[model samples]
Target chain A: MFDIAAVAVTIAIMITMYRAIKGPTIYDRVLAGNAIGTKTVILLVLIGFVHDRPHFLDLAVVYPLINFIATIAFLKYREMGRLD
Target chain B: MIDVMLLLIIVVCAIFALFMKDLLSATIILGIYSFIMATIFTRLNAVDVAFTEASVGAGITSVLMIAALSRTKRYEYHYTKLQRRKPSALFLKVISLLLVIITGAVLVYGTIDMPEFGDPEAPANKHVSPRYIAESEHETSEKNIVTAVLAGYRGYDTLGETTVIFTAGICVILLLRRRINT
Candidate 1:
């Protein structure tokens, strides 16, 4: 069932969280964190369908834009040592 | 039939995403998982959600991960057992796990009270939702009710969400900039 799929994604997210914590490199952690964000977007959409509320998709759409920009900004700062 | 296939794909992708040793591979698998989920959403008649997932989950998130990966090393050290653990760290992990479980339980209980899927007379369908679904195509000239709700009735919320993302990006830039400078 779709419910089971959601649960599976949750478990995967938890595993990704573990990697984020235990990762030896910052990039690994960043990758794991990105994965978590991606999963969250999907989860939001899935929950919307289960509830029959399309409005939740709005949040899903916006979440990635935020997450992506944040990651890029962080990477740019990390590389160049300056935001400006 | 398609539902079952989508569900199976979701499960497989989740498992692969979790257990994959390569961080890049895991991230890519996670993107596929999100894409599969979006397909499932479309199949459920939640077209807007599907669109959002496709845009945000599969598109932007993957790009961000790849960008971050380019800035640093790709693989993480893997060990069979815990090496060194601070007492405080252990305590924090335990507390977080407990909190997660409690929240999960509450959500499950809430789900039990929800109307069965696709019930016509469900309050969601009967209330403002029906009006939106009925009138959105004409009022907004958008055939998708989800698009109308997001861009029309709740336009302000979408703007606020965009602002939140902008703030988060600014904060990340500030934090990492300082680290690199020092």
Candidate 2:
């Protein structure tokens, strides 16, 4: 059951990757990349469980924090055309 | 039965995400995919991992993507063959495909030797992992084992990770910021 869900998520990620690669605009690629990052967090958590490690949740928490910061930074960069 | 169902859903969502023409829709679908994965983690008895996934994957990642999209165009332009095609592109694609296949094969081969899912006696359980699980609560006074591992035994690594994030944030700001008179 869980495996099926994971597989679905993987497929979704692949799709997102395609968009990232083929996206006509930079924003589209960014969107796809962001989607991939989001999926990655969940994938990491699922992997931890499959491995039977409940402790992996800490990684999940940290991953989002970092991912968000990175995204915001990129957005700001794109908006201002410079990183001040 | 449930696992099979989950797998099927995963496959379907993946296909949809891949084929979707609208970038926004695809991005949203990917978010859903992350949430489902988190649920699966919970089902697998990895509460810690599930928690992190829900927070980071569903929350932060989506926000960043949307922010990025808001600053740029939503749709991608498809180029027809008539526009222009470089023959070298075919070679690049073929090379990329080969690279992908080789990477995938290596990953699968590595998995083949892994202990069956949920095997108790696996080395992972027999080694420092067991010690960490057993003693983390007492040592850190933190109920969550994941937290203990991240902040305790691997404190240096966590610090490094945090530093990296901070650096990335700074770099982005520096790159994006407009010139100030000062």
Scored by Cα lDDT, where does model 1 land?
0.67
Please tell me which predicted candidate would have the highest DockQ against the true structure. 2
- The sequence of per-residue lDDT tens digits that candidate 1 reaches over residues B1-182 is 44675577678678767776775666656665666677577667776567667656765566566566666656766644354376766798799999989999999998997998998889988898879978899899998777799999899999997786577445445444434334
- Candidate 1: docking tier: incorrect
Q: DockQ values for all predictions?
A: 0.07, 0.13
What RMSD, rounded to one decimal, does every model reach? 9.6, 8.2
lDDT (10s digit) by residue, model 2, range B1-182: 44554456557668877876765556655665666666567667766566556555655555556556666766667767855366676778789999989999999999998998878889987897889888999999999888889898899988997786577455444444557656
Q: After superposition, how far is residue B113 of candidate 1 from its true place, in Å?
A: 1.8
Task: List ranges where model 2 is wrong by over 4 Å.
Answer: A1-84, B83-86, B133-152, B155-182
**Would you give the TM-score of chain B in model 1?**
0.68
Interface RMSD of each: 10.1, 8.9
Task: Name the fnat for model 2.
Answer: 0.14
